[model samples]
Target chain A: MTCKEAFQEISKYLDGELSEELKRALHEHVGRCAHCKVVFDTTVKTIELYCDGKLFPMPENIRNRLHDLLRRKFHERAV
Target chain B: MHYTSMMALEVNRLEKGTDRLTGKSMSAQPQKATERAESELIAEAKAGNGDAFEELVNRYERRIYRLALRLVGNTQDAEDVLQETFLKAFEHLPDFREDSRFYTWIVRIAVNEGLMKLRKRKSDRSEPIEDAVDDQGQVMPREFRDWKPNPEQLLSQEEMERVLLDAAHKLPASLRTVFMLRDVEELSTGETAEALGLTPGAVKARLFRARFQLREELSKVFKSEKSLDL
Candidate 1:
């Protein structure tokens, strides 16, 4: 795969949407090309890090505030 | 019972079963359990069960808050967006069509709330990122370099995570939301498109742009100054 093609396919590869054949081509391309390999490795790391949904946990204070607010609002609506 | 495994037994993602694209498993056992439990929660909420609604909120608060924080660029505004989104979702619970996942529906509300806050908040957003896009074409960043995180220069995990968050925050609101839901939340591409009210193709385009921008920005931090030729 060419550099441009590699760039374009990066999302598909990370997303697990690539066909096996295309996946093979992407792996082969990145393996042979140092530059593309760097981009690919960094991208893999980036996706993994970003996928950490826990990175920004909701603070307990906010959680309690949300809960209290919901209670009051729902109670008012019920009445 | 464990959250997901328990949910898995009771409900299958009915939507997943009949998803036109996959059409693989409508009666899949595990998915059925998840959908059943969630469906019950929605039904209970609709019937004036505050506790049921809160259970739903508990499941998604962190993710929703994180998206809000990233989109509006601060904890204060993120808090407001989170509050508004749930309030609206609660008020509209009776109107929720069960065809879509509750998570998908609420995310739509959060995105709208986030964008609205963004517009009002940007009056003081000194040189906002959007300003960089004088021309729509110029808005897309394309200057990519081959930079890997070298071992010697590798920062600690926490530091690298901070850099990653910074890069994500730099993304435009539209792109950031798409990336967050699709990548971080692991929503299907179709679900992301539906949440954002765009075509799947459009979602893919924005995702590509978001990923490319992130990859390039991250390279600056991790990539050695010595450049390599392809």
Candidate 2:
């Protein structure tokens, strides 16, 4: 596969959603191409980071406060 | 089908165990009570019940807050957005269409409110918002970098978190919202498209671009920190 074709399929390849034929082709391309390999690796790692939920942690206090506010608003409306 | 049947069997086993422990034939009493309570709450809340609304808020507060925080990238802005979202939902409760799930509808409102705040902030700043980093690297688009050896590895966990948050904030309001909804909130593409008023394809494209840009920015930050340690 050409570099452009491979680049476009990188996301699908990392997602493991690519067709076997395309996956094999892309794997071949990455094996021979340093630049494409880097791009592929970066994309995969980024997705993993986000999926792992390591990037952000919502503070417990903030969550509690928002809950309280919502509850208060609900009660006021009830009255 | 298999999984569902397995789950059913497990539930049946548990029910049998509970019945044996109680020394009586339990007749799904707890399930019926819970169902009744749920229906009553929904009915009362629909009848302009403020207390019911409060109960609903209590149930979903953590999720809503986290959604706001991820979208806004700041504690204060997130809090403001969260309050506004609940207030608007309360005011419009009577008009709510029952066709959609309440949680989904509320989430849509919260997302819109968050986007509005982001738009206002962008306009106030008067800086041209470049959502993605083009090949030129002039505006420094957010994209992931290829993982390299951690040379210095001096960045603390807090520092890395701050960098990630900063990168997210730098994303253009539109792209950033998509990223937050899709990646952070784990909303489906269809749901995200509905929330943002974009087509599913558009949402996917924006998300792909946003992820690319964020990874790039994060890599730059990590690389620079490594250099500074030298």
Candidate 3:
């Protein structure tokens, strides 16, 4: 796989969209090509940092307000 | 997403005692037992059990809140989206046909509410309304440096968040929403397409662009000191 071809496949490889044969070709290309390797590795890291769920925490006040609203609405419905 | 298949997967995942999005166990009850419990909760909630509905809310609030925050890019708006989503969910619970897991159904509501929140905010600012586009051209990587291993550990949580959110926000809303749903929320491409009213091909194309753009954006911050020597 050439660098350009490897570039196009990187995201698909990460997303598990590539077929096994193409995946191997891309993996081989990335293994030999330092640039593609960096791009591939960092892209994986990028997804991980977001998925870790530490970046956004629901603040206590917001959590309280949600429950409060739900409680109030449920009460009104009951009455 | 199909609830029956997801329920089967849930059974398997429950055996491992972890939630994929949150990485925490939702229930310690046995797999089949917990599956029935969730279905029961949904049924009871639909039947007018407020506490049952609350239990369902407690199960998914953090994830839905995170999705809202990413979609709208602020706490106040995210809070609105979160409250409104559950409000709508509770109001419409009776109409939900149980074809999907409660989480999947709630996610659909949150995404719509978040998008609506974005549209309303943009309109309030007199900006042209921009909905998600179906596709984006392929973006080539301009950066080739390796990020420091475990870059999250290098920065404080606040610093990390600022970095991640800043990069994410730089993408136009079109690609940002796709990335948030597919990559961060771990929704399947088809699920994302359904949520955004786009095609799977479009989801794939936009996701391709979004990942490339995000990797480039983050490379500026997390790149190691050594050059690649290429």
Each candidate's DockQ: 0.39, 0.24, 0.50
Candidate 2 DockQ, CA atoms: 0.24
True contacts kept of each: 0.42, 0.31, 0.63
In model 1, how large is the Cα lDDT of residue A27? 69
Cα lDDT tens digits for candidate 1, A1-79: 7877876776676666678788778767766777666666666556555654445678899999999999999899789
CA RMSD of all predictions: 8.4, 10.6, 6.5
Q: Lowest summed-lDDT stretch of 10 residues in model 1 chain B? A: B6-15
TM-score winner: 3
Q: How much native contact recovery, as a fraction, does model 3 achieve?
A: 0.63
Mind giving the per-residue lDDT tens digits that candidate 2 earns over A1-79? 9877876776554334578688668778766665665566555445444433333455777667766776677677557
Candidate 2 per-residue lDDT over residues B84-116, each given as its tens digit: 888888788778776665666778999888877
Second chain alone, TM-score for each candidate: 0.72, 0.67, 0.80
Better of 1 and 3 by lDDT: 3
Q: What lDDT score is found at residue A66 in candidate 2? A: 63
Task: For candidate 2, give the lDDT.
Answer: 0.62
Q: Rank the candidates by DockQ, best first.
A: 3, 1, 2
Candidate 3: CAPRI quality band? medium
Model 2 error, position B145 (Å): 6.6
When summed lDDT is taken over every stretch of 10 residues in candidate 3 chain B, the lowest stretch is: B3-12
Query: Which residue pairs show backbone clashes in model 3?
Result: none
